[model samples]
Target: MDARRDAAEDGRETIGISWSSPTRPARRDRRQRPCAVDPVMEIEIVHLDRRHAGLRIADPARLAHLVGSLARHGQQSPVLLVKVEDRTVLVDGYLRVTALTDLGRDLVDAVVLDHVDEVGALLLRHRLQARRSTALEDGWLLIELLEVHHRTQADLATVLQKSTSWVSRRLALARALPALVQEAVRVGSMPPHAAMKFLVPLARANAADCEAVVVALGHQRVTTREIERLYLAWRRGDPEQRARIISNPRLFLKVEAELEVPPVAPDETSALVDDLEGVAGLCRRARKRLRTGVLERASASERAPVAAAWRETREALRTLAARMDAEEFDGRPRDTHRDPAAGQRRPQPSPDREDVEGVTEHRQEDPRGANTRGPTLRSGIEAPAPSDADP
Candidate 1:
């Protein structure tokens, strides 16, 4: 979707406009009042104001997914809105509104909040959608509030019910992340979550390094795993190593590719035993961490992101267990949504369980249910965060 077009024609497509007051009252900075939500109603797409749409990071993947959902199930959720001098201004659900536009939708399910100005609506949106928000999104949103709305950090902290330090950290996310990286995220050239997790701190450690890395990456579709690898290596590596990473990440990846050393194969029966022991050890360790983790020490709002992350982790483990059960019953293969080796040649089975030269060890899926044999398979799990980073 062309983001620029969103701001262009509010009246371009006329579909099911319930209210058609041509009088657009002038916008003003007014005092915020209590939220007054109207029942969900259909509003004309052309009448909706999306002047603040540019403030959001434009993610094509997210928009595509939303478009598909809206197409399949219709707009089950409502877009948030506020009355600005009688003009209905969008406060949240830009993606949903965009999806409706893509689907040639005339009207949108809207929750118009009364008695609140633009500033109050934005704060309400932040509180309402904090769970689904990424650090990049939150940073930019906070920046919008601080600079565009002329809000002080202390005032924002008080309204958001957070400490001033927490507000600064969130502001620092935008202040600290390189503008180059921020643009990359905004245009979908880079991922917002990966930037939040790996690149922000990398940028703060050395802004030039962040700039160099962003320039080196260009517009390539990099993964969370690759970015994570680069960040960890850069964190620990020396000056020469870090420079090489910034200037020539591909070469770093090439060197990172395990040299043609064949991992010694363990006895099959013993390997099974070792794998079971490893799984048990991991479970025990995870349980111990959960028992002693910072959840008990954190406040309610502070613990929200962490608790949400845990729910995701729990759901993922549940899915894995279900997949395992399915495999036990049917031994069928699962579809790959994103595969690096989509067009790669089938790896030949190693005779006598011996390693083959030039054949890299990757734990990839085969839709054909073929047993792929290799000397070793490297784990590709994302590195677990020691603690959840506040979004």
Candidate 2:
């Protein structure tokens, strides 16, 4: 008997099953007798073992959990089964039915269909059905079902899941990972959840560099931040930056040496005593002289050029500091975003420190007159008070 006919006889295939819109009901003959049972409403257990189940049952935990639930409350749904000679086979519901058995339910409720195709049409039909329905991560659903079916390399088309070749192609990306990276993933050192997110981008950019970073990270005990640092360095850091480490073999060796070597102790006794006595004598003489000789020599040396340069630098720094403070007070700030070309510099106190006393009225003249293109404007200069005269 045809499966369609069997489905119709069992009432499992309702009149409006296929189409989105309902079809008109057939006019019943007046002589037709009413049946005792509504076939569609009844749940019966049919043994269907010969059918090839290709959907993966990979997550055993989930399966066990479902089984536990089923144990508490018997199989609420019937599995679709088709008769094949002496044996009835499962057409769908692989995991759910497995859960039923695991839950210790000896029998399953099933709808009996007449024919069982030698090749599983269920797998193809399911994929086609899924394809029409929604999007998914690359072969994720099919892969899961294959695992459930325990058919890793089975012909997917016949199994109605995925072809063996297709599974191989998709698996290779993950399977071909470096042993060290794989180990890291397995050990929970690298988050398995984010491994793919890290892997795909790295592998696409430079497989060798990706492998190097992974291996390098594995050797040292590293934190997630360090791993992220290395991973991102490869992603966005320039080629020169990557080459600085990779090209220099000695750097790694230097790190190793630092790790292996112990600290050195300072020479004691004579060195300590001689250094202390000499320091004490110099200190006493320097204190007695009050560094007058050093000062006399410094002044006598006609260091006008050096003095002028120092004075100018000090004044410029002071002006800058004043400007910065003014900007801060006014709520207008300078640029803070990093500029690669500008590089980094240590901050110095501005030259405006002494100017705060208001001795010079023209202090607003940018102390660095030549640094900017604009002409410097001079304000009125104020004389020092007689008591506050310069020394």
Candidate 2, poorest ten consecutive residues by summed lDDT: 381-390
Q: Which stretches of candidate 2 lie over 4 Å from their true place?
A: 1-46, 50-55, 113-120, 128-351, 354-391
TM-score, predicted candidate 2 vs. hidden true structure: 0.30
**Candidate achieving the largest TM-score:** 1
- Return the TM-score for each candidate structure: 0.52, 0.30
The true-versus-predicted C-alpha distance at residue 382 of model 1, in Å, is 49
Query: How far out, in Å, is residue 323 in model 2?
Result: 19
- For 1-391, candidate 1 gives per-residue lDDT tens digits of 2321331222121111122222553222234324444667899999998988756777676677667766765655466787888688987778778888999989998877667689976777677453356666767878988888889988998998989898788788777788888888877778877888888889878989888888888897788888898999999999998888999886786778766468788799798668757855775575566567555577779777765765686465445443443332255563221122243333455543212122234443469754333222112222233343433
Query: Which ranges of candidate 1 are over 4 A from the true structure?
Result: 1-47, 54-62, 85-87, 232-244, 258-391
How far in Å is the alpha carbon of 304 misplaced in model 1?
A: 49
- Superposed Cα deviation of residue 202, candidate 2 (Å): 21
Mark the 10 consecutive residues where model 1 has the least summed lDDT: 8-17
**Count of backbone clashes for each model?**
1, 22
